[model samples]
Target: MEDNFSNALLLMGVGLTTVFAVLFLIIGFGNLLIKAVNKYAPEEEKPKLQAADNKAVASIDPAVEQAIDLAVQQLTGGKGRAVKIQRL
Candidate 1:
């Protein structure tokens, strides 16, 4: 009975150690991959807002703007307003 208990404890220890080792290895590899990608990947350029976009937003129909304002007011419990509506 004593021998069996010792064997069980040993098996448990070994299993736990193996599981933790594998998890640590996976975490290390993931971190390394993230660092490598960030180093090698080109930074994306953001699109600049053009003057035409502002003109379009200013030219939006009053009815459509009212609808947008109503939707925003309802969605935000009448605490928010639609300041600018733009098209892509």
Candidate 2:
């Protein structure tokens, strides 16, 4: 009976130690992974003028100016006014 009790105690001690060791390893590795990701993450780049589309506004129709002004006034509760259109 004494030998059985000693054996049970030894096994319980080993199991508890293993559980703590595994938890420590998981926490340590998680911290290392976060640090590595922050070190190598890509930075946000500013938009370049050369990369912008030059013809984005080229398809605007001159006939839609009045309609656009009315829509804008309706949308903005009459606070918006239409500016005079100038032909380039």
In model 1, what lDDT does residue 60 have?
76
What pairs collide in candidate 2?
A: none
Model 1 scores a TM of: 0.50
Using all chains and alpha carbons, the TM-scores for the candidates as numbered come to: 0.50, 0.45
Deviation of model 1 at 40, angstroms: 1.6
For model 1, the stretches where C-alpha displacement exceeds 4 angstroms are 1-3, 49-51, 58-88
Q: Give the winner by lDDT.
A: 1
Tens-digit lDDT string for candidate 1 (1-88): 9999999999999999999999999999999988998889754442332335777776777788778877987999876777656866
* Per-model C-alpha RMSD: 10.7, 16.5
Model 2: per-residue Cα lDDT over 1-88, one tens digit each = 9999999999999999999999999999999988988788643342222313335323445457557766877999866655543334
